[model samples]
Structures are given as C-alpha cells and as structure tokens.
Target: MNDSDAINKYHLSVERADGQTDNLVVSEGHQQPEDVASTRLERVNLRNGGNVDYQEFALEQEMILKARGASKILQVCVMLPLEGAYSMITPEGEECHFTPNQGFMFRYIGEEVTFTLPGHQTVRSLGFCVSLDVFKRYLDNQIPDTIKPMLQPKEIGSLPVPFQIDNFMRETLDRNLQVEAQGSLKQIRWEGTALLCMALVEEKLHKAANPETFSLTQACKQKAEAALELLMADMQDPPCLADLAQELSITEKKLNLIFKSLYGDTVFEYLRSIRLNKAKNLIEQTNMAMKEIAWTVGYNHSTNFSKAFTRQFNITPANFAKKARKLTKVS
Candidate 1:
C-alpha cells in the first residue's frame, strides 16, 4: 500500500481547525472502550516493547486524533504525568522513560505497538480523534511541503515536552468544556488545538537540534516556582521590585529579568494585573461598594481605581459592576 493509504488504514482522523484536517488512530490494541478509559487514568504500568515494564503515572492525559477511515489525517496522544514514570520504545528502537511531569507523542503508519498497564495506577487521560483533512488545510496555509513530511506519522515520533504544556492543555480543555457562553467554547477549543499542534512542532524541531535538552531539573524548577509563589501571595501588599529581589535572594535587575522571562511581564506589571483582576472579581461577586472594593485591591482612590480598571477591562468600574449585576440577575 502507498504511504498515504498505509496511514489511513491504521489511525483515526481528527479535525484540528475549521478547514484543516489531521488523522490519529490509537494502536489497535487500545481500541477497546475499557482499555481506552483505563489508559486515560493517570497511574498505570505501561509495557511498550520488551518484558521490562514502565510505570506511567500522570495527573491528567488527553489525546486528539483526526477522524478514522478514508478521511483520516493526524493523531495526537497526550499523557500527563502526575508522579511516576512510564517507558516506551522510540521509533529508533531505543528504550526511553518519561516522568509524570513529562509527555511523549508517536506519529507513524503501519507501526504496531502495545501499551500495557498494571492495575494499580489511577490517572486521567484525554484522547482526541482528529481528521487529516484539517491538517492538510493547516499545512496548505501555514506549513510547507518540505516540513509536511516532518508532520507525517513516521517522520516524527515520541516528542517530549515540559509539564507546563500539559497544564495549559488541561486548563484550555476544562475551560472549553465548561464555557456556556455562545461561540466561546468552540473558539477556545480551536485555539487550544492550535496551541497543541504548535507545541508538537516545537518539540520536534527542538529534538532535531538537541535531543538531550528536554528534561528540567526538578529542584531548580521548584525553586523558581516557589519564588513566584511568594511573590504572588499578597496582591494587595504586593512587594516592590527591590523587596521581591531580596526575598528571592537575587539582584533586583536579575529578578526583574527573570520575572519577565518566565511570565512575559515585569513583577510590578504582573502584580498590578493581579490586583486589577481581584478588584474586578470583588466588583462582580460581592456587595461591597466600588470604593471599598477598590481599597480591598490596594486602590485607595475610587477615581484611580476606575482609571486602572477602565484601562485593564476597557470599561469603567461602575459600568462593569452594573453589567455584571444585570447579567447575574438575568441568569
């Protein structure tokens, strides 16, 4: 069979965008509903190639593949690790391990593989079946044919990415699933899928250049994360840049750069945004007067609060509060 036909015969197709197509099929061994659901769970012993077992435990998992049959295109499998490791055999026949904070992807055609799980691991995984046509459309517009091969099943296999990507994915999915606003859910879902695709492409490219750079040191990452947590703990009494730098035991300039690098905003800007958001929440959810809500969020002057709120939300505080109340009453 031709390569295209070979891909079609094996994996299911799922839609990635409005006009784009991609196909994904779980290994036939994973076709059973119970089996699929079992894989969705976080902690499972997965044996991929040899007799040696790899225990896979994730906080959450999601898979998106194109539709199945003649129209199939791309397949995406996401396994989010919560607190354990899983083993898999790479396309190069190398045995590799993945931690709970890591993920892997497999792209292939006519390749048979098995994922075995022990009965004790309890984890959640999400699977997406997408269509190839969607990916073709995306490729036609955004990807070149030379790179197109890279996106094909066999060309790219088992790319690993950071756990932050999984958190973003889960947040996007949960938001899309719970959103009740008209047209918002689909918009978010589509955006989420696009982000997932972009992440996959980035992983492939990164690995091609440097295969050894995927893992993050848990201790260092935790230290950076803890510093961020401390900075965010008190929005109203937000720390000055100097104070924050001292708390984190870094120079002020270094702290500013790090905050910007990690969060795409300066510490002061991030804190201001947080305070504004809190003010907004108070306005919408509580019976506090506008001035009191403003004070609660570190804004002492109602006028200054109104100006900041207007700049941030594109509406005056009073107006926003009024609209929120109206919407709540209508609901």
Candidate 2:
C-alpha cells in the first residue's frame, strides 16, 4: 500500500526546539485520536527524518485507545513505555500487556491496537516508525537487517512481539532525552538514536528468534524479560510455568533458568517483588482499601497480604496507608 492507502494517520504538529513548526503525519494506520478530553499529555514532539520519524511524549491517563477499520497498509512500530505498562488488544482479539522494560513490536495492519494504561502513573514513551515504502527496502539494505523480520508485513491480526529494552538503549534514551540540539542538529541526533536503537533491537530479536543450546545471549535475557510481562499480565490468575514455557518454546526448567540467570530470582520470587512494589505505589498514591489493593495485586486474603507486605517492606499495609495519607494531608 502506498501513502494514499495510509489514511487515518494522526497528524502531530511539531515545533522544533529552535522554534519552527512542522505538520507531519507521524503515525499511520490509526485514526485521529478521539475522546481527547479524558486523556492528558505533558509534552509531545515529533521529528521527521530521512527514513524514520521519532515521537516522544509523556502520557497520564487510563483509557482504551480506539482504532480504525482494516486496511492494506502495514506499519511496524516500536514502542518503549519507560515508566508504565499498557495492554494491546490485537485485531484478532488476542490481548497482550507490555510493561516497562518490555518493549514491543507489532505490524499495525489497519486495525485497532488498544493501549490502556492503568495504575494512574505517568509514563514517557519513545516511538519510532518507518513507512512501508521505507521499510520494504531491507533487501536493498535501507534499514538495519535485524528489523527485517519485525518489519515484515503480516496478515491482519498477527500477535504482537515483545522484546527487552536493554541497559544500553535505556541509557541512550536518557542521553537523547537530555540533548538540547536545535533544528537540523536535533533531527540528526534523534534520527541517529532511532537507527542506533534499530541495530540493538534487531540484534536482540535475532537472538531471541534463534537460540542455540541454552546459551546466555542478550536476546535470551530479552526473551526472559518478555516472559515477565506475560507472567504479570494477569496478576489475578496468571499462566502456569508449563504454559509460559510452551509459548516460548522452551522447557520449564530452561525458562526458570533464564529468569534465574538474568533476574537473579525464581519466577515466584520475582513476581512477589513486583507485586509488592505495585502495592506500595497503590498504598502511597491511591485511596483504595487494603483488601482491594491486596486482591488487585493477586493476594487472596488480607491477612496473608498484610503479612507479605510487612515482610517485604517492614511495615504493615494499614499503617503504611495511614502514614501516607497523613503525609498527604500535611503537604
């Protein structure tokens, strides 16, 4: 599909740091953003490049983003949600939740890719996109080859692929975020960052797709990180180890090893740490009751929840909430 078929794209008006305006269609295949009042954005900027467009923004809301009807254009998108998690319901009705450090790749095939943000946390997201025309030249070596599989146009409703955003990319994004370049210099810096990310992501995905005899590749660690997202997707009733292993096409023992080697914990222990961290945020930020917080984070009983919370943080949930509320009142 050509540019004409790529209608329904969102037009993000951009003003460079040097104070000039640009009207570029950065994201395609999704309709113009609707229900705008319900969402809030602190800042958003789009920068056009030779073959890629970089978009950076911070979002604070909890809403299901809508999509348009099916079309022919296939847009491969890379999104890194640095501070929060989002759920994407694929067009075929499969749902996947992507949390921080769990970057995702998907071919936006002219359908709705719903992203819902919970926990009422503010997250900064960095996104990069190359149009189909630009993406199709992998055989000609336009974009990095690692992205070829990810950029491959798929049938409608293909499953979203998850990847781990490693420490290098994280630190690179940090430095890129701090750059104060103006005009064309700004474009050079960010677009370079975009391609640099492309190389790293490609290498990571290549490892994940082709794992030899139980080796410890960055890609292996990346797949483990992806598993973490799926494991915690439904804290209430998550999939079992067998199921997760089947999804990754590895044995249960190997899956546990990946988690152990990369994260230094068994799956259960890692999950406990994550659950308690989420609960701590809830106690400090939201007004939800102890039982509600407990259940939300997968605890079945408040007594057990209080015990675990105290064990994790050295303070009971009730007292923690009370102290947090008191501090709120004081401030």
Backbone collisions counted per model = 65, 0
TM-score of 2: 0.51
For model 2, residues 164-197, the per-residue Cα lDDT tens digits are 7644566577577668877678657666666666
For every model shown, what is its TM-score relative to the native structure? 0.36, 0.51
Quote the lDDT for 19 in model 1. Answer: 31
Q: What's the lDDT of the predicted structure labeled candidate 2? A: 0.61
Error of 2 at 160 (Å): 1.9
Report lDDT (Cα) of residue 136, candidate 1: 47
C-alpha positional error of residue 141 in candidate 2 after TM-score superposition, expressed in Å: 4.3
